[model samples]
Each structure stands twice: as C-alpha cells, then as structure tokens.
Target: MKFDYQWVKDPECFEINREKAHSDHSYYASSQEMLMDESSFKHSLNGVWKFHYAKNYKETIRDFEQKDYDCKDWDNIKVPGHIQMQGYDKPMYVNQMYPWSGREGIKPGEIPEHFNPVGSYVKYFSVPEKMKDQKLYICFHGVETAFALWLNGEFVGYSEDSFTPSTFFLSPYLEEGENKLAVQVFKYSSGSWLEDQDFWRFSGIFRDVELYSIPSTHIKDLFVKTVMEEPFDEANIEIELKVKGKIEHCVIQSELLDPDGTEVLKHEFKITEKNPLLSIPVESPLLWSAEYPHLYTLILTVLHKGEVKEIIYQRVGFRKFEMKDGLMCTNGERIVFNGVNRHEFSAKSGRAITKEEILEDILIIKQNNMNAVRTSHYPNNSYFYKLCDEYGLYVIDETNLETHGTWTDFYDKDIILPDDKPEWEANLIDRANSMFQRDKNHPSVVIWSCGNESYGGKDIFMMSEFFRERDDTRLVHYEGIAWDRRYPNTSDMESQMYTPADEVEKFIQEHPEKPFILCEYAHAMGNSNGAMHKYTDLVKKYPQYQGGFIWDFADQAIYTLDRYNNEFYAYGGDFGERPSDYDFCGNGIVFADRQLTPKMQEVKYNYQSIDTTITDENITITNHYLFTNLDEFVTTIMILRNGVEIESEEMILNVMPHDSITIKNPFTPLDEQNEYCVQVVYTTMEDTLYSDSGHIVAQEEYIYPYQPVQTLSNKKIRIADDFANGVTRSTPKTVGITDKSVA
Candidate 1:
C-alpha cells in the first residue's frame, strides 16, 4: 500500500488496510500468573513526538514519511494531544456550522484545498526484546478527522473514524533497531461531515497510542451473550470464541465466577475450528440492574498440550432489557433513566480525558442521583464503559456520526448524509458496528443510539435495523426521527431533544404505543434546567412517560492563560476563531473544572428514586426503585416550628420495591406561637463506594398553616397600663390617649 493525499477528500476511502477485528477491548497477558497485572507485551507510545504543522497540503513537507527525510529541526509536540492546544493552530467551537463555512464552498465528500491544516508526526522506537518474536500490532485509540500511517518508510494504513480504536499490523514493517513511525493527520475529511457534533473542533491523536503483541494460541474475539428465560429465573450463557494463529491441539476452559469469587459453572472444549460456539446454563442467576449491579466474571483459559498458554477475563451480567407493554424495562421491571448527556471533556485537555477524571465524573453522577448516562454524540474511550459497568450506571452508547451542520447551513430539505445517500450507508453502518462490537460485553449499556441530530433517512433507519439485527439484548435509540417522521420506526422509543414537558406528555397520551423520552432535555446552559421537575413529575403521572437525559453533564471549556498570566477556563470563540458557538458550549450542571454548581441540587431532588411526602399527621414513603427496597435507607422525620427544627426521630424503613407505606408522625407538636412543618429525609444506611453513610438521597417538607396573632392598639395598651399602675387620674384620659394625656 502507498500513502496518498487524495484519499483524505474521499468519503468512501475512510479506512485503509486496518487490522482484522478482534474481541471487545481487553488486556492480554501471556500467563495466568500475570493475568491481573499489567501486560508486559504492551508498550506505550504516548510521550513526545516530533511534529511539523502545515497550513495546507501544498505547504506540508513532501515525502516526510521517508525514513531519512527529517532534518532534525522539527518542533516537539506531545502525543495524545491536540495540535491546536499546543500553539500550532487555534481551537474553534462551532455548533451546526462547518468551520469552513465562508472560506470554502465544498460539499459533503470534498474538503478544503487551501486552508486545511495538516499535522505530520514522527516517533522513533525499537522493538522490545521480549516482543521481537511475537506478532506485533500498533493501535491508535483515537484520531481526529482522518490520518495515514507509515512505518520505516512503508505505508501502513489509513483511518477516519475518530472515536474508535484503529489497529494495524506492524510486525511486517518493523526493523531490527531504531524503527521510525510517521503519521499525517488531516484537519478535514469526508468523515468531518458526519462528525459535525456540537463540540469544539480539534484535530490530532488525542487519545492513547500503544503497541501490543499477540500470542500464538490467542483468542481473537469472544462474544458472550447472557439470555434470561421467560420466568426470569434461569439464564443461558452463550459463548462464541474466535481463535487466531495456531489453534490445533488447544483446549478452551471456561469458568463463571460469581461476585463473591465463587465458581458456579465450568466447561471445557477442544478447538477443532477457528470459531467455536458453546453454551452453559445457570439456575437463578443474579441479574444486573442500575440499582443492583451484580457482575459475574467469565474467565477463559487456553491450554496447549496440558499447559496454560493464555488467560482472558470478561465480566458478565445476566439481565434482560426489553420494551414490554409500551415501556422500557430491565430485568422484568419498568426502568426510568435519570440520565445526563456527557461529553468527553476536561479543563486542561480538550477531549484527552484521564481515567481519574472519568472516575470522578462517574462518582459525581452516582452521588447526584443519576442512574444513566448518554455518551452524547459520540462513543467515549473503551475504559469508560467498564467504569460504568462496575459502578452501576446504565449507558446509552451512541455512534460517532452527527451532521447537524448539513441542515443548519444549507437551509434546504435535501442536504443530509445517510438519509438517502447510498455511498454513506457503509460508513454509517461501520460506525454503529464498531461501537457495538467494542461495547457489547458491558451490561450497563441498555440502549444503542444510532447517532445524534443527523436527521432521519433510509441510512439511519438501516443503522437502527442493523443494531437490532446484531444484538437483541438492548434497545435502539435515535432522536433524528423527530425531524423526519416519515421513518418513524428509526427508533424503538419516541425520542425527542429539548421538547417541553407538556408536549411530551400530550404526545405520549395521544400515541401511547411507544415510550417517550427526552434524548436531550432541560438544556443545562448557564442557570438553565428551570422547571425540570415537571418532566420528572410526569414519570409518576404516566407509565409511557419515561425519564430523560439532561442536555449535558459538564461545560466544554479549555483551561488557558490570559495576558495577565491568570489562568481561567475558556469556551468557544475565545481562541480568536470565527464562526464559533461562543458560550453556548457552557451548558452543563458541572463546571469545566469538575466543580459542582447550584443546578445540581435541583437535579438531585428531581431525579431521586425515593419519593417521600411529609404531612403533620403522617409521612408517606414510596419506593420508586425497580428492584431494591427502602430498608437500605434510613428515614428521618423532623418537626420544625417557624422554619426551625423542634424535634427529630429516626427509623429504618421496610417499604418494598414499587410499594408505599404510611407511618404515623412520632413527634408530639408543641403548641408554639408559629406555624409547624414536618421534614422527612431518606439517607443511606450504610457506607458505599461513592458516598458515605447518612448521605441524604431525598427529602421533603410539608408546612402546617396557622392563624396569625392579632395586634393590640396603643390606646388599649395605655388603658391596661393605667389600671395596673392605679393611675385613676386618667381624667377620663381619652381612650385613644396620646403622649400628652397627662395635660
């Protein structure tokens, strides 16, 4: 293969010579002893890389991928970083408008010729002695727009999808020592048309890049499907393994370990073919849900001639997610998604988020009573799904395709991709398949979203159908159908973005055939989310009205230094860029620096699963949880007079799931001179990973009306004083006596 610049402008040539597909992301170790430890077969290429920035293709250096072409004066730029953030170019944030709007008159498949930025990166490394004999591969976690790769002056591959991992076989191109790896990342491509998400435009290798080795008898792919029977008691674990390289005389050993590390089921098989399918049955499996995320480990050990060659670990959950009775349910219980759309962003880095940052975000979500998260308009890093699975947050995994700019810029009815464009169908389906293949093993993902704001068309409908055809374990979601009702079946649910609560209610009441959810609602722009409670209240009023995800979780601002040397967060248009969305990117409950805002209080209150109603005579508690009971929470009742607490009592609640209980108020109200109020609070009874014990989950207050005290006139006060002081000389002191009454 040879590198060519023209491929950057072609939509059909998005990927070139990419490596074969493998199982969903996992760390591989050669031996069972090092299974839990870091793999020695992998090497990180995430440090500094020699870089040269060019304003256009013509200005870029020619034959830069050649092994001896560099003159050793190139600038140093950090890998896994955006060139714009490193002073090479400028970051531009535009929503529903192309960055080259006025400068160029290009269409969907063509890119700008004069102003397109090109980043040429070079890294020199040697093959590790341990991995010299093994089959080696290079993986790019993410790249913006499009890019081409060359190793030791030989063309490797080209890829355009920016969110998913792009792997290439490097063993064939490697040298004995001092091998050179070159990459040319383009700022624009045909992929950029579909990537027109409402986010800041950045280009580079903004994610991790590493090299890994594969063993001889390795498991190339593994698909484990947990299917629950009708009674929801027993589950069938179907395992399909795809082996690469040498598989003769190899034995596959599988084990299912419960959460407590107890092995329940074990199976053994001989590898006679490249792909093998096996099944195991379990009785009364512990199903997973947002409330109770019970995970079971599926360990696969490959034995070659009575010796363990490789061990693969996968976490599995047996649960059913389906649409039954016009509602979305999980594990046979109706589910409500108290979710928020999350963008992979940070203050210091644009989209180069760290694991610590992801953990913090998930923890904040859990503490704030959020049960689900939508990966906004694109798929996030592979590790994010694992965190969501472990932390018990339902996920709505979305594909990396959005063409909001098509309709907004053209102002025409026929300006979109994957709608009726046959050329874009393969790209659209490839994105969906990539997301599904990478994130299929996670039980937290309850829905697969086609894309965002791309508008409905045959391509999108096909994408939705592709998801359903591939995986029946999860439901399909696409909000573009709201734009074009011609393809109403593009989504399983009636999904809408930013629609008002009343409108949603009316639609659900009128239709009632499918569940309604606000895919993006309560726009959390600065001081936004007002009246969000109405939507949450609708969840209680109608069964078809499921909850929705908020507009976003955090502001998409980059941290930068101003002229005064003071550091602050910068949003759109701050970097001397035109056609930007400006402060519109600051729509988040949390600030860019990971600080909580006042809006989170309202979100917590509205999204809390427990509903408590307090009155002077009694307190009623409703367990809104689908599976768990209220007993795990400590309920406290407080008596307050004139907004001040007068008495308090605490007790453990025993309300079952989806049930309510009324308890008589235990506080004896004091006959005070002010109105009374009863405050009921629900708190965690035990300490958990995300929060401490006694953390308040929900609270409600009810006020008791009281009669106002009457006021006495000054004349009545004077008359009483005269009687008490025995001042009979009141000279019939005018009943309405003034200060001169003594005269």
Candidate 2:
C-alpha cells in the first residue's frame, strides 16, 4: 500500500483530510475542572515513543504502520522533542538560504532527494474510560515540516504548516483494544521553503501530542472581541461561538468576572443559530493595557435540559487598537511600542522552549519596560501567547512563512516565491489563516504580521487583505513592503527592518500619511545595541515615528560537548556542517542561556516610560506612558556626598500621563565644597505580575555642589596659537637632581 508521496514536491498539495484551524481555548466538563486548568477530556500522549530515523524518504521503513508490525523493540525518543536534538540527526542552521540550498541545487518549492531525514514514530494507547463512547480525536499541537498519520494500519491524514496545531479524527480507525498510532515525519517538503526562519532547523514532533474527546455539543471555536463606543471606558463584549454536534435546545449561561473576582455581567440565552454572535453592553468597563493587565474572565456553561455538558473560562480584555489621526493608537491616545523581536529558542532545546523559559522571558520583558514583542519570524507555542495575555505585553503574531532564500536577486522576480505567482497563493493564505485562527483570541496580539523577509508580492498583498477581512480589530503588518513598493497597502504602517534612524525620520517627515515603525532594528549582534537611543529619540519628534523592535531578545546558541568533553554554547558550523553562517545567529540582548546581557540595561533605560531628571534645586518627572499616571509609582529622593547617601526620603508626585511636573527641593544645598548628588528613583508601590514591590522602574541622578570652573592658577595663562612652536621647552634641559632618577 505504498502511495508515492509526490505531494511532498508540490506546493499546492500541503494538506489532505486535516481538520480546520480553530481557537486555542480549551474546554472542561465542570467549573472545578476549569479552575484547576485541567480537563478530563484531554489525554496527553507526550512520553517516550518507539522511533526509527531514516536519512531520506527512500530509506524509510516500509509497512511500519501495519497492525502486525512490531515496533516495541525500536529505539525510544521523546514525543515532544526534535529528532536532531535527540541524537538522531545534526541540527542545521542557515539564516536566509535553505539548508540544502547550494548543496542540492533544487528549485523553489522542491525538496532534496538524497538528504532529507524521515522519522518513523509509533505510540500505543487505549481509549480512556471517560472517552469511551465519544468522538475520539488525535491532535498534533506542532510538528516540523510535513507528516503522515496512521492508526491500526489505516491511513488517517497528512498535514503541513509546522508551527500551528493539526488535529485529525480517529473514530473510524479506532479498535476495541490497544491502538497503534504511527506518524512518519519528513524533514523537507515544499513547506520547507516557506519555513526558512533564521533559527536552527530541527525536525520531528516538537510539541505536545494529545488525544481528546469533546462534549456532544461543544464549542469548537470561540472568539471574544471588544467594541468601544463613546466615553471609551465603556465597551461592548462581542463573542463569536462556533459549536460542534447538536447545539439546538441547549442553554448557555455566560458570566463575566472582573479582575477583582466580581461578576460584572451575566446572561442566559438559548442556542438559536449555527454560528452565533453574542454582544453585551456595559458602562465604564475596566480596560486592559501593558501598564495594567486587567483580564475579565468569562465563564460559559452549556446545559441541555438542566444537564451541564461543558464549561469554559476564557479571559476577555476590553481595549481598542486602531489607527487614529495618522498614528497607531491604543484606547484613544497615540501609542509607542517598546518592543523586542523574540525568537522562540533555547541553548538546550531550540524551538522546544520550556514553560519555565516562557515565564522567564515574559518576566524579563516586563521588568525591563518592554511593552511589546514581535514573535520574530513565526508563531510560537500557544502557552507563550497565554502568558503574554496574563502578564500584559503587546504581541505581533506572525505567520510561519519566509521566502528569503527564494529571492536570489533584487530584480529576479521569477525566482522569488509567491511573486504574484498563482500556484503559491493558497500556501501563503493557509499560513495566514492558521496563525490568525490559533492566536486570534489573545488580547496581547495587537497586530497580525504577514511574514518576515519574503519580499513583497501580490500573494502577500492578498494575505494582508485576508487578515483585514477576517479580523478588523487588529492591523496587518508586513515589512517586505519596504522592499517592493508595488503594493503600498499591504501593511497598515510604514514598517521596515534595520532602517537607520535618520532615514526613518526623513521618511516620516516626507510621508506622514501612515505611522512608521522599524519592525526589526538595532541589530543586537554580539550584545551591541549601538546608538539605540537614536531610534527611540525619534518618537518624541514625530508622532508618526511610533517605535521599533530590537533585532532579538535571546541568543540562539546550542550547548554541546567539545573535543575536550567540556560544554560550550555552539552556534552555526559547530556541528561540522558545511556552508554555514557561523555565530551570526547569536544576536540577542539576553544570552542563549537566558541570562541578561549588558545590552539589556541599555534597552531598559532607552525604553523606560518615565523620564526623570534631578538637579540641585528640583526634580522633574515626565510620564511617557499613554495610559498611566506618575502617581501610581513610588518615588524616592536621595542626597548623596562622594557616592555615599547622606539623606533618603519618599515623596508623592501625582503627575498625569504625557505631562511633566517639577517638584521643589525640600532639602537645603550644602554650602561646603563637596561632590553632592541628587538621585530620584521610581519604583512599583504594589507588586506586579512581572516584579515585586519596591522594584525600581526608573531613576535619575545629578551631582553638584562643585565649582563650575577649574583654574590651573590665580590667573589663567591663555596659550597663543603658535606658542608651542616658538617657545623653547620650559624644563627640557633639566633632568632633575639625578640623570637616572626623577626628582
């Protein structure tokens, strides 16, 4: 039953019988289960699995999915891991070019024949008792490249688009006893050309694998959006519900819980339509922002004839992100993004970043005053967005598509992928749809990025339109439009990468029709964000100059043993791979091991929302936050002499946002000639999700109480222009008392 996998070479044939992409919201049977953040409905298949690695497609084991085949004796590999990281294949790193670019001479949308690795994986499990009579489904949260699935010797489905979740129904192939689930993952496919991200290329089942059963009438997909009217504080909560199975005659009990755990709104309604939109209006609702992450939990319970079927605890946020008066604005005021481009990576696991790492990343971002994050080249794990929502950080959710290597030359349009090519339209559209569907519900996701470095084309323009047509709450972003001006409307803003500060200012001055942002800037290579202040300074000069993202947040280096058995963080070309771009990927403000670099301090100071200045007579505070006031933080004043604090006291200054206030000096200046310093530090008065109380957010220092002029003598002897040329050396002939020793 060998069917030629010719689809691997065809860009159009990416998926067959794969389930449609859906919301990341999960469901539970009872409210208790929802509170516990656990679902009895989902059964995790993430563990050791029987595995075999093949160097190429032709070397793959035949009939490996057969019911009579024995795979228990095969080598074991972790389910949620990359084959390369598990000692099966070497991890490959190529920035813009494909891994086999110069080696294979393959065309775009074509895979290598002799070197693509294939992983054969088998896991055996029996259906849980709770899921006995339900519609069983197998979910692959994420798999690299392309893969085919089988159950009990029957072909189930095939899928691609490596970063998004792919689910397939297994009811037809289910048996009474133990079932054999086999998956064959190909290292390269037509999709490989689209997923040419700068990070290390690793292939396998690298995300969670789950088997789950849904309620008879389940909310298959859920979208919660906000509509703000006058007064701005008040908004309407809009929910789009897509239900599966029979939903008629069922009743929905929905309630909105505020951040303080109070029920603000509750309604009971009967299911009446196939896909329903429920809207609830409220006055003066709590808004969500990076400064204040106010999440209102919405609990929806489905009941049919007084029998509860499912309950969902979905976090909802009330905020508006739109273009207001030629500038990107959130809520009502023009906004600035203090952001970093984050690649989902680690020195240990590559893209398989851990939960702790995600939390660490978010906390570091928040504590360092970074309000936004650009998920550099692709969509990260779902948990990353969830934490971003909870901890309050703006996100630019990007699709898994990059054709950088395809554009061989600036004028070679024929070689570039999706360069108005009809055959490649569906693939880009699919990637966009996949990203939007999975991350649409997150409040942190303020923008949808088409992709990175794919260049501009009609296909990408159509993708922007697709995102706009599907979701109006967020804007579409594409940096490639800066490369090609054929489609000016592909991006909502004048987005660019690595654009110089002077050029950015010039562009905004000349073309203020749209807001401007450097999608990737201040290339933090080798821990150098040189002249970062030059870019951030433009935000004050022009409203159109919103902000920019640093090239990266964390360095992408892997730790491996050297010849001497000592461990070191290895970048490209470390594994003896050829044609590599060595150490070019190690460009992060933070080290590959997640330690803060010296560059992070510069970032914190440059991106800090509060501007503080201190002098001998007064201290001035300028609140740069669009939504927060200065009074929310605790400000401390310190008087120091010769680096030692002589006086310290706390003071309150309720300065409004976008406004500045100068407080008079209460302490008298010392008359004695000494090095006196005045320091003002702003810290959090209350504990935040990212930092504890008393954590300094911003500070300023000024030293004074010294003479302004330095005198070499009572009367300054001004030197003539030609004094040095005419004057004989004053003491050159004298060699002190002794010739060998100085007097």
Candidate 3:
C-alpha cells in the first residue's frame, strides 16, 4: 500500500510547557482555574503565531523550536483556525471512505504517509508579573489527531484525542525573560485510526490554546451527585474531592441554596489524615427539571490547622433520571424531548467556536422551545456542556469515535459489515468508556450514546453493554444497531431514522416490547418533509410512540467575503475547492447566519403543546401543551366583520397550548352580509419569546351570508357488465354528493 509518510509521525511529544518556558509570579496552586472574566486568565496565545506550510510532515523543518529559526521568510496564520480554509491546504471530504483510500490502499491500524501534512507553529509570549511565580501549564482546548510541544527547543510532552482538553504541567524548566513556545501538529497519529468521524478532513489547532496558573493549595477535581426522594421532600448528596497540596488535615463545607439565594442546608466535614470523602444528606430538596431547573451551590474549603488554604465553588443540580415502564422519566415525570442534533461547528472557524458563539447557540435553542440537544458524531468542548447545564437542556453526550469511512467502499471494494472484525470491538468499547469517564458527573447529560453511523457488530454490542455495567441511571442509544436484530439489545428504545408514518405505526403495532422513537426522522435536508403532519399525528395516536428530534437546527454556512468584496455567508464550495459536497451541510431550521428559516414556522406549531386552528365557521383546538395550566393564557376572541375588524373582545376561555378546546360564536349576518366577510382569530394574550409579541398565529376567513343546506340522499344505482358464461358476478357501487362535502 502507498503511504502518506507524514501521517505516521507523532506530534504529541513537542507541546509547550508554560512554567519552564517563562517567568511568572502567580502562586503555584491547583491545576483547575476559573475561566470567567477578570479572573487573570490568559488566552492571548492564540492571537499571534509564526507558521510554516509543509507539503507533508516529511518535508517539515525539525528546528522550528530554535528561536532563531528564521521564520520571517515563512507565512503567518491564526492559531485557532483550520489550515484548509486559511489557504494553507485544500479541504477534502469523503463519506464512508477514507480521503486517501483511492490513492493509498491502507487498512485498519494504518494511515497514508505521502500526503499527511504537519503544521509547525511557533509563538513568542511572556508571563505577567502577577502570574510569573505560579506553576503554569499550556492548555489546548482541541487539536486534530495529535500534537507535540517544545519550550525553548526543549521537548515538553505529547498528547492525542483531539476533542478533549489536554494540559501538560510545566514547572521544572524556568526562564525569567522572553520565552519561545513551539508546537508540531501532525495531520494524523496512531489515535487517528480511532477518530475516523464522517467529516471534512482538515487539520490544525482548531480550538483555543492558552496558558493557565494554579494556586499552591487547590482543588484538583470535584464530583457532585445529588438524589431527591420522597417526592422531592428529602434529598441525599454525595461529594468527592481530589486535592493537591502540602496541607495535612483539612475542613470541607457545603451549602444548598435556592434560586432566591436562601440557604436550604449547610454542613462542614472534618477531614482527618485517614479519610477524605465528604458525604452529606439534605432535607426537603427542590428538584431540578426542564421546567424549573433549580440548582444548588457546593462550596469546598481546604484548611490547614484552622486556617483556610483555598476555596472552590461548584454549581450542581439535584435530580434523578430513570427509564420506568419503557418511558424515559426525569424527576418521576415522562420527558418528551424536543431536541436537535448539533455539530460543534462554525462557518468561519470550523470547530474552534468561541464562547460568544456558544452562548448564542444556547439562547437560540431556548428561544425556539427546544429543550434538548444531541451532540452529533462526537463529544464537544467541556465548556459547552457547562453552558448546557446552566441554560437548562438535556444532552445525549456522544463519544469521539466514528468509523464510517472504514466500513464502506466508494468504488466497489468489499463491503465491510459491522460484525466482520474482531479488533473493531475493543477499539469501539474503549471510545465509549473514555467518553463516559470524562462526562459522567455532568447532570445535563441524561443519555449516553455509543457513537453514530458505524453500523452494528459484536464489538458495538460490547460498547452498549459497557455503558449499562458502568452507569445504569441513563439509558444507552445506538441507532445503527436498529438495522441489525442480532443487537436488538443495543439501544433501550426502538430507534429508527426517516421511517415513514405508515411504517412507524406498523412497527409500533408489531413490537410492543419497547417504546418507539425516531432517533432521526423527517429528513429536513433542503425543501423536504413537506408533509410533516403525518408523523406528528402518529405521536398523538400512540402513547407508546414518543416524540422525535429534528434532523438539525441550523445550516453549516460560514461567513466570508464574496467576489463583489461584500461580506456574505458561504457553504461547502465557496472557498474555491474541489471534492466538495456543496450545500449538503446547509440543512437547518435556522440559516447558518442564525436567521430563522420558514421551516421554523412549521416546527413551532407542530411542536407546540397546545394547538388551536380557527375558522370562520368553527374553531378546533388540541391541547398538547404540557405542564402549563390552560387558564394562564387569556384567549382573546376577535371577529372581523368584513376584512376590517368590526368587533374584538378578551374572553376567558379554558384553553391551553396542549389541551383541546372548541368554542363557536353565533354570528349575526349583516343586512348586506355579502358585502362583509367573516374572519376569526385566536392568539396568546402575552408576548412569548417564540411568538412575535402576541401576534395572531392562527386565523381563518370565509365570505358568507348563509348557504342553503343541501342534503343529498344516497340513491343506489347498480351497474354491472358481464360476459354471459357459466358464472355471473356483480358488485354494486353508488356515488352521491353529501351536504358536508370536503371537495
């Protein structure tokens, strides 16, 4: 097989070590640091960087770490961006087949070497006085495949697994003056075999790179888990602390506070030299749910001889999740997830999305009445999950593993089925375990998915079993397993994608063994899913059939400048590229620029718990609105006498977004009733984030005086045509027009 020689070079060994590379006065403390504003945090390392482009890793310079490496002759590029989109390399995309499959016939556990490029990045940075004394570690939020670090030409360390944070402590090598940080990012590493996600193949330091300091005595890691029982009248709390310091004995304390800042419970735990686990129980806890996401504060203090050494605060929720009677329940109530699949992305920045973009996404989701999100394809940034916890959304956190390309052939190679390999099982199970260990403590993550689109196999089955063994509180999800009956136990629910309405009903009827959920249905790609009502109608008809999440929420368009020198949104091929599946990534309810698309109008009404459709002759309302009392919304009845509103009044009606209410108003025909048309409108009394400030959403009109009632009696006239033989057969059919004809 032809090789991409650069693909085999490991880049994780040369990453920067902040402490030895520069001088800082910041106190040496815990590894974790606050990322909030004004916290003396530094993220400016990403702004300026001297860059060198290499055709492949084999041609890259090894002396990039040397301060006098004459990088002035090379081009510069931004650190937190993709090399492909920034004019360094070309972007290549292939589905179910590796990008180099045609050129290099490499199999599992191997990568092409001829074309694997390496990005050699160098940056000059200095430590501020306040942070000069502290132990510092350079952190990378994300890097594709692998990266290596070097400080002042001295090798720091190596790291792989791109989607998660990898921080290397740098304290031994110290310099009091100007410092040079160098890094070698390989396009592929040994870990690349596991990161075969179905996405455009590109590489670079696509996430934030920063230097952080830790105090001498600090909290290393915190685990907070809470349980509420007795109908939320009592609570049990468990807190585990990992500390790093010279302190002998310590004191830890915690307090449970309400949203109003009132303390519900407070306790202090005396830590002896022998014991460190602090477990406390609370009484009368306020449960956290999607409707009311109540949270509590857990504060831990490390002390030495009664003097406080350091203080750490964590915000957590007290709730319980279960799958009771084939229904996923949270806080003892069934949850109907209104979710969207989100690929951690940006049009301009690739996957290195900023904090502002993250905040904007959360706000958009909330405003659209979407309560849950599925991290499609892979795990996202750690900070993204923290935002989901704060903003109140359930998460089906997925692992960073997708082998879509390994299983399928583009030009007719042998089809690699899921159960074909023995080694594939172990590799997939490791991915699942790693993701669960990193994100297990998060409350927003209610379900653990076993990755996506790899299809089913014994190895995939083992991954599902691993989840149940490690964590039973949440159910496991793997949609591809639905295609293979051998792994019927793969997902807890009967999940399918894009199943038509009739098929769904048949499946529900045939299999009452499990609840039905469209893990992905209603192919909302381009102008599709026009008849969405058919699927929603099934949800109302079958109690065993739960709701499904939409295909996506936003188009993956990136911001760019057009030929006219005007800033515009661009899709796959706008960057002058080949081998691009242009606009296939633009499937979203909202446009890539964050503007609401017309499809949202249909989504909003269909997902609304309350349904009301008004007509001049009658009003039909179906209340699917959950939780809210119908009486909360004042139903305003407005009658337009003729094109112009002749009368309007607010009448109290027992109506809700999720409940059915029918009301008919007797109308008095005008003397010249033909001159006037009748119009009826129903709307909410108050402005909602979703609705346009109490604007009428459902209205109907009819021109009428009063048509005379015409009832046609059914008169049967049988007609039969037969060739006279030994047998004569006839079936009578009749057609008649009725008074209430739909035509």
Best by lDDT: 2
What Cα-based lDDT does every candidate model obtain? 0.86, 0.87, 0.66
TM-scores of the candidates are: 0.94, 0.94, 0.81
Tens digits of per-residue lDDT, candidate 3, 66-145, equal 76665655678887888877888766644455666667666655556787778988877777676788877777767886
Q: Model 1, stretches more than 4 Å misplaced?
A: 30-35, 707-743
The lDDT ranking, best first, is 2, 1, 3
**How accurate locally is residue 417 in candidate 2, as Cα lDDT from 0 to 100?**
82
For model 2, the superposed segments whose C-alpha errors exceed 4 Å read 1-3, 409-411, 666-674, 705-743
Native-vs-model 2 lDDT? 0.87
lDDT of 1 by residue, 1-743 (tens): 68877888877787899875555645455444345557766899999999999998899998989998873578999989998989988999998899999889998888888888999999989988878899999999899988999998999999988998889999889988899999999999988999999999999999999999878888877778898857778889988778887778889888889988899989898988889888989988988887788999888888878777677878998889999887899888889999999999978888988999999999999999999999988999988898888889999999999998888778776676657888899888888887888788899998999999998789999999999998888999998888898888889999998887888888887899889889889998877777999999999999988889998999999899999999988988898899888999999999998899899999999998888776667778898988888889888888877666768888888889989999897765555435678888989999987889999888888877665344444343335667878654323223321223211
lDDT of 1: 0.86
lDDT (tens digit, per residue) of candidate 2 on 11-36: 99888878898898878998888889
Error of 3 at 620 (Å): 6.6
**Relative to the unseen true structure, what is the C-alpha lDDT of residue 491 in candidate 2, on a scale of 0 to 100?**
96
